[model samples]
Target: MSDSSFLNWPFFEERHRVLAAALEGWCASHLPVDHSDVDAACKGLVAALGAAGFLQPSGAGAGEKLDVRSLCLIRETLARHDALADFSFAMQGLGMGAVSLFGTEEQRLWLEKTRAGKAIAAFALTEPGSGSDVANTATLAEKVEGGYRLSGEKTYISNGGIADVYVIFARTGEAPGARGLSAFLMPADVAGLTIAERIEVIAPHPLARLKLEGVFLPESALIGKAGEGFKLAMSVLDVFRSTVGAAALGMARRALDEALARVQARKIQGEPLANLQMVQGHLADMALKVDAAALLVYRAAWTKDQGAARVSREAAMAKLYATEAAQEVIDAALQLHGGDGVRHGMKVEELYRDIRALRIYEGASDVQRVVIARTILGEAR
Candidate 1:
């Protein structure tokens, strides 16, 4: 809706530009500004995004092929308009991405159902003891006569309480680490699976902790090979992380727009704030950071689209830079807004909260720094 500059980059095609325009128009009309019920709002956004066909780009096609660039573009646009809308669209793809990437035909079929908005999907990997240290997962899935019995708890799960289906990870081997892990598709209606608690954060979406007590999933539920769950999860993150950056980019762009509008119209010292040299300097700095973030995010997305199997370095760089820079940009926008920035119902106020979580989720800023350093050092070897 803002502009098509990013779509014109070499990373996108004509279709991507068209999608950007269409989604922008759709979001302008569809996104609900009223924040009455967050859950209902999310559900409505999901159904609207699905109907508008924007959610389609989040996953692989019918043939197991995904367009990462399109995914990033969609996130960037949706995020600019509404962070919740972006989240709704993203979770659909991320929660079901494993199935799209590594699932058998049956899994793909299930994913198709979820992708079409008929069912909500979730990804359950985090546990109480394991946030960044995924290998330290204590959740266990023991092989049984007919299937696997999953016994573990996943905390901080997005869409945890609301999802109809989940891609759950659990340890299956005696080996002390990630080697023994496996991923399974567990439906919410399955016996022994429960939403333990709904976790609230600064920016509220549908988040919860899950308790799995002897959850029996048939062998058909396993995604990819046993011991490949870690790889599968990492791979999925590789694709989605950059999109996370794109989401941040969208928020930053919105912040910049808000700042520009405020500066241009608000009067100060007998003239408009835009007439102040200091204000111009702040705007310049904000614009620089935004462009830098865009470059990193689009570069990562483009590299992945070019068929790079693992984009750990690029993705980390993108996520790290874009999220961090967006924070600074948003803060500047808030500064520009003065008292109005923190007003209860102001857009920048909401964005301040929305942007805060991006720095922590998907991967935290510190975790991304470590990831980028590791990749750089590993390449030198």
Candidate 2:
């Protein structure tokens, strides 16, 4: 099995190993359909995941919860089986992570409800003009008599149209950058909050552009201190970005497995493809990349679990290497499959689309490079 060696890695403990096995077992029996209905598929996956109790690791209870190592392991395994499954699981944790990490008592309650699959959650930070530049956000929130009135648009939001609650970042002060921003927990029922457009991508999911037109939020909606939204967003990303790499690692592993199975069973030049030196070389490369990606991903996750408040450099490295590596691995797998790889609804074909979004979201590969460089320079100074 592709997972045989992954369990022996030092980054994982007995619990992680057990969780991986259990999730794999569950997925074998309960995996969702491989159809094209992205939104319906995601909702079904979410409900199934929640019901199966797989969402717990991502949505642990308040105080001393959510084993990061286990979360990564689950993502890696699910991603190997189904990319949409990974998305359904990862977003549950990330969409509500800020509340888990920095929210008030009320927010904690909201998180608990969402974690239980009673509601959907979302994180809204990206605007049309501000993909990687948080400081340049045009979203504005003006303090009203008893609350704040928010006005702006956020694009590329996962679970946007369906989320029951959103952690939204907006400029609260007239100051020019990230320092002027703040975060608020806005309910989907809030006045003037609308889904402007549903976005379609290479691998469609429930993504949308959110428009807030003078939406008034109670003072209690604020999360963390005023002017700390950027920091909060970054902190949440630091914790979750490595998991993205873990998901990519999962995809790469599955792709490698698919290639291996196909090559061993199919004949090319008067023999099994696996007997060819070129095929062997490609398999070796895929194996090496999958192992290396797993190590980087788990290392970052382990660092965060070991009480590091920030894992900027490590997370960036993990995300950058694992995601890019997964792309290469998936491409090689596709090559090994030849025409079958590109066949509609094929596992490798779906993975090809699934892996593309990882590079663009959380932070783009180029943005991650900038982050790593800046962190290195700062440490040196």
Candidate 3:
């Protein structure tokens, strides 16, 4: 299913290849075939991923910088194996990404526990009103004696109800639009906070909406500075966005694999489905998309690892193309599966659901296009 030849490309190191192979073997033997108890399954997956040392790539330990190529490889492998597994791993990296990139000594203490799977983590930036328009943040954080009193709500937060700590964004009145926002490391059990709703999605892994009436936090909770949240958020997003594309590329590869198997194994009108020219065309197209997407995803990741200041444009292009390409690839695979594709418990059915969300989360496709165009046109978003 995987195009292993891509691993031989200059974008990856020998260490990354070793890590990918090790994690793939671990996932094959350990990851559950069914996540009937989605919550428990997620917890278990996190613990397993951590214990196997795969989670170490998250760079949660002190003084360790994340290797984007390693992150991309793990994501691609995990997504190919289990969607929930990939989500669990991704949320951990994202929830702690801010701290990993910019947190002070005390602020990053929890990374040990988070990376060890002893503590759950969440990144709470999206609101009911603003998803991609991060500048329009509505969640208010008012200055108080000891710290800030946070009020307002955050919706569609990954690992929301379950997270031990959240990297939260809120408006602080220091400025307007994006500058007014601040990032905080808030504990889930803050006195004035509540998990207002536990959302159920087509593919779910602990999504929730939260309300903070007057949550109080110490001044030490801030990540970077008050007016620096927007910048911090963008930096964190830049690192993870390309990995999202890698995950999509993985799913697309799996879909192509499934399509190839189905076409060759199934018979139609006294002949193999693989024998049909039309089926061959679909297979060829699927293969092309998967490969092309891989090139973009790894290119962005490799560029970042090479110490470029920011790979924003490359990241956006990778995410936009890979996610959209994965959707098409998965749909084509589902089409090849015919009746069995939509049937419950089918792998292709699950892949169809799994691939849809990549386009929407971590900056939607439309938003990515705007970002790419802005970068090319010498403008800012």
Clashes of each: 0, 0, 0
Per-residue lDDT of model 2, residues 236-266, tens digit only: 8999999999999999999998999999999
Model 2, 130: alpha-carbon shift in Å?
0.2
Candidate with top lDDT is: 3
Which pairs clash inside model 2?
Answer: none
| Worst window of 10 by summed lDDT in candidate 3 | 56-65
In candidate 3, which residue pairs clash? Answer: none
lDDT per residue, candidate 1, 1-381, as tens digits? Answer: 254576677777898888878877887787644557778888777777777667777677556578888888889888898888888889998999898888888888767766677778889999999998889989999999988999989999998888888999999894668887889998899999988999988888999999999999999999999988888899999989999999999999999999999999999877999999999999999999888998899888889888888899999999999999999999999989999999988989989999998988888999999999888898899
Score every model by TM-score.
0.98, 0.97, 0.98
User: Model 1's lDDT to the true fold?
Assistant: 0.87
What digit string (tens of lDDT, one per residue) describes model 3 on residues 1-381?
A: 466888899888899889988987898897644688888888888888888778777754566778999999999999998988999899889999999988889987878778887788899999999999999999999999989999999999998888899999999978879988999999888899899999999876799999999999999999888988999999999999999999999899989888888999999998999999999999999989998999999999999888888999999999999999999999999999999999988889999988888999999999999999989889642
